[model samples]
Each structure stands twice: as structure tokens, then as C-alpha cells.
Target: MDIFEFYKKMDADDIMLSFKGSVTSELLTSVLQIIEAKMERLNEPSKIKKKVYNVLVESLQNLYHHMDKNEQDIKGHSTVIFMIGNNAKAYSIYTGNYVRNENAEKLQAKLEKINSLNPDELKAYYKEVLNNGMMSDKGGGGLGMIDIARKSGQKLNFRFQQVDNEFSFYSLNINIAKQ
Candidate 1:
């Protein structure tokens, strides 16, 4: 990768943190801590910081658990990308990883449903899902996306690009306002 171009882009976007590689629990923890510290230094309000941190935890954990688990190499590596940035209006978090083509349609539909809900409807849906005790092998009852929507108060921007007959790249972008 062109390091200088990457650096310039990040600088221009006001990115606070970024990572592209495998996600391990240890690395996730360190990333969270680093971002928390950076936000503190930046004088971000505690409320915004907490919201950002909570949504981030869910986001990263989802990556760790629900991504293309079979794509890992002998080194336990899978390709993933994450970025966090801020501008005058908001803080933005982005994550991209591969998903099996079979799973992509389900994920797309779920995100669309979540995006369709209003805040109150989202809370009701969240509660309903929580109460149902239904969870996937990844231990998610579809609450992560809902929670991301509720916390961000913004529609999740996502895309799925076919990589082959078997897999597609999934990208999610979330923005949290300063207000």
C-alpha cells in the first residue's frame, strides 16, 4: 500500500484511528483503549465518547465473531478493515470484511429492516429480539445492528460487492453526531 497516500487521506479526513488486518480479542481491547485515550485527549464530551465506545465494542466484536470465519489462514488471519474519524458534524466509524455470498442477502435484508425503523420502533424491536432469546452461532440475536442504529441515530450505510461465487465484501459506515 502507498503509505504516504494513505496518511494524507487519513489526515484529510480527520481520522483518529485505523486498522486493517485480523481482529483478535487482545488487539480489539488495545484498539478500544487507544481510541478512548485519543478521544479524551481531544476533549470529546463524555457522553459522545461513551456512545462511540459502546458502539465500537459491538462493531468490533461483530467483526471478530460473524465475519468469514473460514477464510482464516494457518496463522489465524482474515482480512478486515476498520476506521474511526471525526469532522465538524460527527464521528464516523467504518468496517469492512468479507462474508459468504450465502450470508450476504440475509445481512442486507436485516440492515434494511433496521434502517427502516424509527427510534421508538427500533427500541421496541430491540426489546423483542432480546426477549426472544434467539441467537445465531455467533451469539448475536441481531441486536448489534439495531444497537448501532439506535446509538448512531443514523441509517447504516452498507454495501456488498461480489468477490466470487462464494464470497462478497461487506462494508458498513456509521456516523454519530456531536450533538
Candidate 2:
């Protein structure tokens, strides 16, 4: 979808932020400030704020590391997009990035595995992965998705858009109830 159309689809009761280009520490910090301001304006409860913040940090870091490994250039680069918003009933965060077709397939499989689990099963799986010290140097192995699921208390939402034969845009969304 086009950028304007995407923005229009976002919930009106929520604040929305989008980032394109390289994932940089400075940009991430600025985005965090804007999000915090919006959260304050919405008078979000402390618990919800904490969950949102944690998810944002993990998701952004994942983008940064992924971009770095691929040596992606910042100028005019279409690497990653981070979007956050909420409706009256829930808050949602989304992250999208270009991935090789192979990587996309692997990610899809991983997401499917996570999505198939109940909360208790997910928690057990997360702890098992954690105990095994299987986390990648990127600060996540599979725990981030599980964490998002647990914190949001909802199933992970995701989509994959094929950009070409070789690459696809992988989009993941996490939604949390306001109540």
C-alpha cells in the first residue's frame, strides 16, 4: 500500500509514527521521545507504557542489527519501517524490513511456530530457549516474539509482501489491550 493510504488506515484515536531509511541510534532516540510524548498526551497507564516501551526497544534493535549485518546504506535506503498506534481498545506496534526470499521463508516458519502456541506453551518455549542460551548476539533468538506475545496478551500479527522474486517485505505487528 502507498504511504498515505497506510497512514489513513491507522486508528484515529491513536498516535502514529513511521520511520523509513536507515535505523540509527539518534533516529531511534528521537522516535522514542515522540512516542513518550504521545503516550503522555493519551494518559496511558504506567503498565501499558512499560510494555510498549519494551516492545519498541526490542523491535528497533532487531532492525538496527539486521541492517548493520547487511551493510545497508542510509541514504535513500528502504530498509526498515517502524509504526506504532492504538485504537480505543488496544495499542499496536509494527516493524517491517526487506529480507531475502530465503530469510523471509525462514522467518515465516518461525512466526508460524510462535503463532501456533497458546500463552502457557509460548512461555514455556521462551523459557526453554532462554535456558538453553540460544539467543543470538543481536540480543534475541526467538524470545522477542514470545515476549511481544506475552506482554501484549495477544497473538502475533504479521504479513509478507513480495517485492520481487528475490526479496520480500516482512511486516510484524503486536497488539496490546488498553484495559
Candidate 3:
């Protein structure tokens, strides 16, 4: 890899924090603290800071809990990618991880449904799902996506790339407006 080129790319992308590793509780705590300190140093408004922190927590928690550790193909199958970016319009958080092939379509459909809802519909849907008490294979039955969409007030952006016969890489991008 070209280190200089990568640095330029990240700079251009306005990436604030990026990590590719196994997600652990300790790492999550450190990440939250680092983001909190950075926001304070940047003098971010309390409201935006709260929204960003809330969504980041849900995003990382989804990653930490739902990782397919026994996935095939990669040696470090549990490894995941996460990034935070700052730009004029928004703060973006992106995450990627492997999913069992069987669950890919279900997850995609769930996210698509979430993205289709308006604010009121999302709120109602959240309560409906909450009442249903369904748990997905990885748990939550798309509850995390619902919460992320509601918190960000933006449609969830996502894709699934086929990695092999048994697994697919699931990528999610969430953006929270600065204004």
C-alpha cells in the first residue's frame, strides 16, 4: 500500500478516526472517550455531540454484538472496519463486517425498509418492533438500524458485497447533520 497516497485520501475524505480490528468492550470505551475529547476540543455544540455519540454507540454496539466470528475465508474472520468522518454537511460513521451468507438478504431487506420510512413511520415502526419482541439471528431484528435512522434523521446507507460462498461483507454508512 502507498502510505502517502492513503494519507492523502483520508485527508481528502475528512476522516477523523478509522480502525480495522476486532471489536471489544475496552476498545469501544476508548473510542467513545476519544470522540468525546475530540468533540470538546473542536467545541462542537451539545446537541450535535449528543446525537453523534448516541448513533456511534448504536453503530459500534451492533458491530460488536453481531460479528460472525466463525465466518469462513479470512483468518481473522472477526475483524471489522470502522471510520468517522467530518465534513461541512455532516459527521459520518461507517462500519463493515462479515455476515453469514444466509443472513445477508434478510439484513438488506430490513435496512431498505428502515430507509423507506419517514420520521413518524420510523417512530411507529420502532415501537411496533419493540412490542413484537422478535430477536434476529444476531439479535434485535433490525432494531439497531431503526434506532440509527431515527437518531440520525437520515436514511441508512448500506451494501453487501459477496466475499465467498459462505460469507458476505456488510457495510453501513450513517451521517448526522452538523446543523
Lowest lDDT sum, 10 consecutive residues, model 1, at 68-77
**Candidate 1 residue-wise lDDT, 97-165, digit = tens:** 887787899999999999899999999999999889587777577789898999989999999999877
lDDT of each: 0.87, 0.79, 0.89
Give per-residue lDDT, candidate 1, residue 11.
Answer: 96
C-alpha lDDT (0 to 100) for residue 158 of candidate 2 = 90
- Of the two candidates 2 and 3, the one with more favorable lDDT, higher being better, is 3
* Model 1 RMSD, rounded to 1 decimal: 2.3
- For model 2, residues 1-179, the per-residue Cα lDDT tens digits are 49787666664535577667788889889888888888889899999888888888777887888787676533233568877877777777888888878888998888889889998998898899889857676667767777877777777789988878877888887877788
Superposed on all Cα atoms, the candidates' RMSDs to the truth, in angstroms, are 2.3, 3.1, 2.2
Model 1, position 166: C-alpha lDDT score: 76
Question: Between which residue pairs do clashes occur in model 1?
Answer: none
Runs with alpha carbons beyond 4 Å of true place in candidate 2: 1-15, 72-78
Between which residue pairs do clashes occur in model 3? none
Report the error of model 3 at residue 179, Å.
Answer: 1.3
Predicted candidate 3 versus true structure: per-residue lDDT over 6-52, tens digit per residue: 99999999999999988888999999999999999989999999999
Please give the lDDT score at residue 130 for candidate 1. Answer: 89
Best by lDDT: 3
TM-score of 2: 0.85
Positional deviation of 3 in candidate 3, in angstroms? Answer: 1.2
RMSD of 2: 3.1
